[model samples]
Target: MADFGEILESIGDFGLFQKLLLFALCFPNLILPFQLSSLVFNHADTNHHCNADWILQVGPNLTKEEQLNLTLPRLPDGSFDPCKMYVPMDWDLSAIREYGLNETTTCTDGWVHNDTIYDATIVTDFDLVCENTNIFRAAQTIFFAGVLVGAVLFGPFSESFGRKRATQIPMVLMLIFTVVTGLSPNFYVYLASQFIVGVALGGFRINSIILATEWIGVAQRSYAACLSQVLAALGQVMFLAVVYFVRDWRIDQFIMAGPLGFIVVYIWFIPESARWLLYRGKTTDAKELIQKAAAINKRTVPDSLLDKALEEKPVEKGGIKMLFASRVLRKYFLTITFAWCAVNLAYYSLSLNVGKFGLNIFLNQLIFGLSEIPVHFFCMWSLEAAGRKLSLMGALIVGGVLCLLTLAVPQSNYVAIATLATCGRFLMNGAGSICYVYFQELFPTAIRQTATGLGSTASRAASMLSPVVNMLEIYHFTIPTVVIGSLALASGIMAFLLPETRRTELPDSTEEAEGKRGPKLSNPATRDCEDIQATKL
Candidate 1:
């Protein structure tokens, strides 16, 4: 039987139809970074001190500086304590000044935030500072938890339904929840809406790649994967621009949600995945879509070729269990999934806590976003040149080493810390970009979405922990860096065990995916012709 790849070649491996589909699927990728990284902006740190307005009754004539000096305690650093204030007394302002306040307590009133950088953030609006800081981190954790849930649920949902449906539904849900998130009356409402948005984000992120890659040829899979990220990186840059100008989390949320409305409308035009259709035993629908694609690409698929594709039997539906049945698959599954977790743990830890670098948050985020475009582009080449395993391993180990190197730098030297972090982010992103192609190629089509979803679930689980790990910096500055770097190093070592799938056809069945069979070759004639052409050149 002609496998789906053979049919893709006959009709158009990367012809107009495939290009159109790839373009459409990748467009939505631009908006995802807004949700993923928005926390950095939405909960940005603001200069604040405890509100001590009650003292104003007695100190009505006191200047602003005088009020703070008299009402708030100073830390050993000589800065006014942000979380504490002097207990109020019945004495007059003159007597209070002479005696001085003896005891301190937590902020009795609200926080007074200096919103010069951000006019408003979830932090300032909800007063998620000092004792309430963990609540902001918890909001991030909740969002990633939603992503984890979405991965488990949407993976199978896409497998059962068509990929187009999976993609479309999430776009709508993302839009709705994002709007709700902007209008949230309280912190609890914001958390709930963000969680739903996270769920939708998880579904769209997974299925978009699967739907695009299922139509693309094996040769272009790296390009298909990395290009989506390139656009996402650009989106990060653009979102930074939006955040820079808007400066309010609510308006930012509404602006981010605006693009999705158009995406939801246009996505309906894209067809369902032919590979998915065939996998579901809807061969007729698969054949029809293929024919339409072939026509659109200005090519004609042979009747025999189409008939052979139809003759291939549908895969059994056993969900994730199918991945564990084979010993070889189990090893691949474990190795790749752990690698996914480690990379995300490192990536998001730095990504979420950009403020810790002590640089201008906008400039810091801009540099971070700008860096990914080149790194991902380089990754596209490295995947083809150095091969998947070597590329992933090199990026991870090197990135981890850079991450560890930060321990020697003083936190007060924000410039030095930001420099090392930028370098670390550059390499970590490369490792992450490689995983997208690596994961898709490792599993058979029968369980590809399931495996991808589960891998993403592991990554999201890491992302959930990433915020908590960042919180550990409160105990000791070195803790977050140590944990992140250690995991990257460990996972880099784990990458040594993964089989190289460079220049190989994607496996289509359990038999093909097992043992050494996972790295199945392309058509002998085509490969030979390419080799011969290379020799002649």
Candidate 2:
């Protein structure tokens, strides 16, 4: 039985065919950032105060400033209290001013929103303020919850049905749901629509990585993975381009959905994973696709090589049960999943808190997108040079230290705090990029998608909790930093437990995953460390 990597090498691994396919697969990443980071804009905080228009009937001639002064209470800073109002009484304007009102209570009428920063947002439209402030976080959490659900469902779907269906169906669903989200009349409707959009996002994201990785050879898999992430970071920058101009959340949704319409059509032209076809015993289909790829690359696979490939019949074992049946795989699953969870937890901790940096929201967001681009580019080299384990571990541990150092900086020095936070974001994001390639290479093709999906599930679960954890800052300024930094440190320590997959082909069976076979096929030099580790285990 010929290895898939050998076949990929023979058919021109990173040639014209693979490049075109990778381009098609990576294009959607540009749009995904809109949905992923939309919360920052969609629920942007604005200046607001309790409505006190009830006094307007008696004080018809009163100026807007005088009306607010008479109808609202003041805090120590001399600003009108945002959530409180003075009790209204039937009196003339001059008489009301003469006799001061002492009683204060929560706003009986709805709040008035300032539209200076954002023309409209879910926060303004729904009055998600004061008592309802937590609702915005809840909605964002629900969206990530949907991402978790989609990952759970699509993992088996991709492994059983095929990667093409997993990718295309979600593209269509994301398009439909994004439009639905934009047209949502009520906050509840918006939440439901965003949840479905998240579901579609989860399905599309994991399978895209798997399908692209499966088609590329071991040597260039780093390029395939890192470049896709670089594109995703560029997508984040593109998100700023769209949102910076269109401030309304509804219009933003509509604009972001526009690109997916063309991508859905173009995606159909790309072929399915030939490696997946062979693993499923669809040799005829795999053979035809491989031959076509060869023709496109201006190369040829010998008939004898093709004959031997068809003769390779894999024993099919898959699903969640198969994932945990082996002890070594279970260890890999737990370690990688924690790495996924920790990276996401720390990543979103900084990303979602873009406002605290004391910079323009659009500029801060641009800084975030720009910073990630180079981190991924660096990952492209370090993943191949220092190897996966050290790269991820070093990134997380160093990033964690930066996050903790923010606690020592004075709150008045926004510049210093911002600098530490930005550095942490850079390292965490780099670790995240490495995980996409590292996780795919760690598992066999039989349950590879399932493993990836499960890792995504764990990451989404962590992301879902990130907003809640960030909310802890209300209790103590240092609470969120302590928690996120601690998790990053622990997760970096856990990375040492995972085997280094550098210069190793993706395994195709449990036997190969367990080191019973195929390790020698890629590089005996690299496999020695893995085999020795396996023996000790």
Write down the lDDT that model 2 would get: 0.87
Question: Per-residue CA lDDT of candidate 1, range 1-537, in tens?
Answer: 577888888887888998888888888889999997788889777889999988889878889999999999999999999899999889898898899997999998899997677889999989999988788889999999999988888998998887888888889999999999999999999999999999998888888888988898878888777888899889999999998889889999999888899999999989998988887788899999999999999999999989988886856667678888878888998998888888889989999978778888888989899999999889988888899999999998999999999888886888988989989988988888788888889898889999999999999999899999988978988999999998899999999998888867778887777744534345659768878999999
lDDT of each: 0.88, 0.87
Worst 10 residues of 2 by lDDT: 515-524
Residue 510 lDDT (model 1): 76
Cα shift from native, residue 47, model 1 (Å): 1.8
Q: How do all models score by TM-score?
A: 0.95, 0.95
**Residue 245 lDDT (model 2):** 81
* TM value for model 1: 0.95
Report how far off residue 462 is in candidate 2 (Å). Answer: 0.5
- Residue-level lDDT tens digits of model 2 in 429-534: 8998888888788888888898899899999999989999999999998999999999999999998989888877788888777665543255446667887999
* Candidate 1: residue pairs that collide: none
Give the true-structure RMSD of model 2: 3.7
Q: Which parts of model 1 have CA positions greater than 4 angstroms off?
A: 312-314, 515-537
